[model samples]
Target: MNTRSTSTFGHVALIVAHCAGMVDLVALPVWVGTLIQHYRLDPQQAGGLVTLFLIGAVLSSVFLASRFQRVKGRWVAAGGYAIAATCFGVLSQPLDVTTMAVLHAAGGLAAGAALSATHGTIARSANPHLKFAIVGVGLGVFAVLFLGTSPKAIAAAGGYMLFAIFGGVMLLAALVCAIGFPDPEREATDRQGAPVAAIPRAVWFGILGISAMALVQSMTFSFLERVGNDRGFSLNAITGVLVVLGFVNLLPAALAAFFEKRWSARSVLMVGPVLQALLAATIMMAPGFYAYAAAASVFAAVMIFTHTFAFGLMARLEPSGRAMAATPAMLMVGAAIGPVLGGTLVKTAGYGSLGLAALLIGSLAVLCMSRLPGHAPSSLAQEPA
Candidate 1:
């Protein structure tokens, strides 16, 4: 194939990999009410399901990070999706709420595997810097916001069936990617199945950035959904808010090409939390719906920019294939923690507290961020300079 054609195919693989990672969380909001009604679960208990998923993810990342280093990237990706797919199929059955939560947790374990493995795959591929950005856009923006935000048939009798379909598609995509995409084993590791030893300080910083952002996001997004409902927003209106939020998220990444040249990665990482605190304050002070929407939009913009820029910065820090491959696994640590913190907060405090808590957390994250080592300009940033 021509270079352009190869690049196009590679981009397709990245998007597919991202979509697989995305299905784990995107449909969550849509299922929230249905899970409550069907399972007869209280708000706190229903929220626990998400917490359980996080627990499974955290444990999996801890244990499997090294083992994944020993295995072929394709196999890891395949196993994660297969397990997730099977769990989703089980969930489609008429089980008690407890059973459903357990099944979801099982799926979470699978998702953790897929997520770690796909990151490895992307990192080892040719021109991985571009691939990382693509993953951010495809998974972070399009798959997450578009497919995840789409209203599912959660309230319908065949809701479980819909979930099953969702799982099946993810599984199918994983399988196809595994089969069609080239193996990353050659690039990801040296002989004897060990990744290289060059660890970049900026990678650690990236992990810190990801962890902080995920926590604030979980707290705020979960809170916004619940509080908006409390404030008498219709489900349709809530959905509209989510859609707008997703679109707004695309803004920062869209302008990343411009910002990276002018600003340091540290600067980009710092913008998100500061903006989020401002937005959270706005939401707290504003009394009208339009004001709330505007706040949400600004928050989304900051988050997207932060996540994309930080991820790109991390990829630049690590030059070895496998070390870079492990970056996402490290980053997932934050992802796992975020939802659990948010769920616990919601259980204790009212939804209003979510924003307030995030504001404080964001402030602290900014302080911690100053201690992290800085990264040099990414290749993208160097181009056209």
Candidate 2:
């Protein structure tokens, strides 16, 4: 095929891989609720299980990201998802908590490796922000379908069906990637053919900012269903909120893409955490259905919109793609703590405490974002070789 055709095909593969790898965005609520209701685990235990998965992802992504230049993206993407699919398939069987925990961690590790490869390739593309937004739009579409149907299906077929669906999605991603995942051009090298300089301190702070926001996102999101159910909202009502959330999810990435040149990335980054904290507060503390539904519906959009800009900024700051390759670690490191921390807070201090936690964490996010340099240096902005 021609270069244009190959590039288009690679974009498609990246979108599919992104949607498949980031299953937590669409599935976390159901995943946690299923464990609580069907598997008979407490909030902390259920959250801890999810935390283990995020921790595994973080560990693997951190390990692979630094070596992104040397690794083959196509094979890594194909192999990782295939292994993750197997882990999820096994998880579908009736198993003890210990076995399930091991499977969850293993699956997360495999999936994170694939995500690292996928994101590294995107960072190396001609337009990292636009590319990330395109994939985000794809994920939003997946969220709509997954949210609209998965609940009723799980209700009918049992919680194990969730794992089955997860396995199926991962398997599909593996197949697609194996057939056509693109190998982007490698990062720019020095005269000695060495990789570029280390990632800037400012970029690290930007990453930390995104990670903090992710923690807040996951903490509140993991309990969205439970919060509604506990407040006596009907299943249909909660599901309606989720469906609306999914539809809402479709807009942010497109909006981010549109606003890319218009808005300052730093300004967007600064506003995101504040909006995230406020929405999270409303979702957790609202006494009525409408208030909770409204807040919950648009909550995920904040992170989606903000992260697009942050992803672009990081790509600019560290053009080698090493920092972007660490995307899973940046996202999941905070996420690993969120569920368990949220659960502990809910169990001890009640849901209102989540609002307080969000405030504190969001402040830290703002602080980190504030530290980022206004622009990438000339040296860091050059295209990778």
Candidate 3:
């Protein structure tokens, strides 16, 4: 096939892989809830399943993507999905809680590899500035759908059957990836395969900004549904909020890509934290479904903006697509860490702690953004990576 043909196929496969990730992520809370009930486990024991999944993701980013250079992107993603599906199927079987936890861990390990490979694919195929938002939108779209809709279906049909359906989805997604996605970089580019380093000192602050933005945004996402429920919001209202927020999340990304020609990446990232803090504070004070939904929309937009900018900077710092792509891995680590910290804060201080924590994290990010070195102005939507 021609270059355009190859790029098209690659893009399609990458998007498919991203969509599959959303399916897996959305299905998790349901599965975890089932495990807790089925095994008569404590919250801590059930929580360990999520922890293992995240740990697997973090480890894959740091260890698998960072060090391994020989593996092809297509196979890594497909293989991981296959493994995850197989594990989930086994987990659905009648088993002890300990056995189920082991299966969950194995699935998580596969998901880690799948996650990194998907990032590498998207980074290689698209421009850096748009990578996160584009991927975020794809993820948010299906996530909103599944997380928003699937729980009721599972409740009506039977929870165990959901795992089988999810496993089938994984198999379909993996097959699509294996057959369609090409190598991340053409074979000839091996010597220069997206070389990246720890982001440069000049951009350290920008990195911090993105990380902080992710922390706050993730905290909101983790708890907002519960908060909405507490506020007596109906299921439809909750679903509306998620759908709206998902749509809102794409706006900043689309705007950033459209204006990257005019705006410095630093300038774009610098706008996220304050927006997040204001919205978070508003939610704390108002706590209505409408107010909370509006807050979520704006927060998602700003977070997308900050993420795209910082990822763009990372790509600029590491021209090697592969190396620059690892920024997602790093962000994944921060994301994994944020929820645990947030849970602790909420447990000790009550739900109101979410507002305070958001303020702190957002403030730290703003401070970091203020100190980042400026890049030369350019119209190029894609960063060097």
Candidate 4:
């Protein structure tokens, strides 16, 4: 019954719960592909599903966490998992597009609340960068397993059934871990449920930086295969590049976690954006197979470094945790907008447009990082919230 005693279990449980919720966005391509085939729909029509999901996710992340952040953790976790499982089950049933959209939206709401609660808890850890890295690793492992099992599930039952089954499993696991979470009241110290505009100006800049980073990432990554083709890469070569890039993604988080004490968060924050711009330029200029492969690998590594630190910054920015709660929403919102932006660029010029766009976006992120309260030398890892 003691909150302090549950620290170890609470940490692990938060990681597990966050990963389960994150899988939806992390594996968007697979889910969207399956949906397109199942419904005989165009990419645009299927894409609307993602938009609705983000809308639900953003709404709940901001609304619920802001109001009830002081509520008990177990209640939030159990309630969220229960809601997600129920929605996924209903989502598997035969329904019109309108009906399906509503269920998906409900599922997103549950996921956002669950993710925010867990992530906000982790944000308070003694070493948030390390905890965030663990999140990245957990996601990587889940991605491999999800992809491996998904085909068989899809073949035997259907894509819809896969969601129901996974939802059930996640629900059970989350329920078991319900008692492990530490006190939400302590994790999220509400400023009497403060209004949105009450957030510090510096924190707003950090949020904007994170959103811009996500925008550049999704925009480039979404059409990477097409970019490879445009660069005259063979299909197998492109697959090889991405396969290696996948493994490369795991390293940065591990490295960042290990080096947490050694590096200043501000140093990492500033350096990361520059590296991102450089890597994006490499893919643009080199125009060779090996260059693309190398750039992709480096980009993956740099992202985890930046993403983890930026996330930690938000946690420190406001102990009320409202800013931290919006992370999932910001990421999804940026991702939802990226394709349209990238698509416009591609139509106007070529794949080179992505490089130019990244250059501009990365610059904006750097400028935003400058405004974060912790950007000063000594305040590197100190809590600014």
**TM-score to native of every candidate shown:** 0.83, 0.96, 0.82, 0.79
lDDT of each: 0.60, 0.89, 0.62, 0.66
Question: What lDDT tens digits, residue by residue, belong to model 2 across residues 1-385?
Answer: 0123236777889999999888887788888888998899988999999998899889999999988878888999999999999999999999999999999999999999999999998887766888899999999999999999988899899999999999999999999899889876543444237747878899999989989998998899999998898899998998999999999999999999999879988899999999999999999999999999999999999999999999987898887788999998999999989989988999999989999999999999999999876556666563422
Tens digits of per-residue lDDT for model 1, 305-372: 67656655655455344444544444445545555565666678755566777678787768756654
Q: In candidate 4, residue 307 scores what lDDT?
A: 80
lDDT of 4 by residue, 1-385 (tens): 1134235676677767876767653455445545665666554555567556656766777776565456565667667877887887787777789988888788878877777777666665555556778877766666556644554566568667666765775686468557676654234333446353466778788878877777777666655655665677875675566556656666777777776667766677777877887787677667678878898656656766778877766655564566776777777666666655655666677768778888888899898887765433344344311
Off by over 4 Å in 3: 1-6, 22-48, 93-97, 130-134, 158-169, 185-199, 203-205, 376-385
lDDT per residue as tens, model 3, 1-385: 1133245666667766776654433444344444444455543455455556566666665566654356677788899888988987886667776777677667766767776777655545435556555666666566566656655665566656656766776787688888986664422244555443443565556656776776675555555555666678876776676666666654666776777668876676666788877787666556566777788656556766666666666555544455544544455455555555555655577668878888888888878888764563344223333
C-alpha root-mean-square deviation, candidate 1: 4.1
- Give the local distance difference test score of model 4: 0.66
> How many residue pairs of model 4 clash at the backbone?
3
Clashing pairs in 3: 194-320, 194-321, 194-322, 195-320
**lDDT of predicted model 3:** 0.62
Question: Which residue pairs clash within candidate 4?
Answer: 316-385, 317-385, 318-385
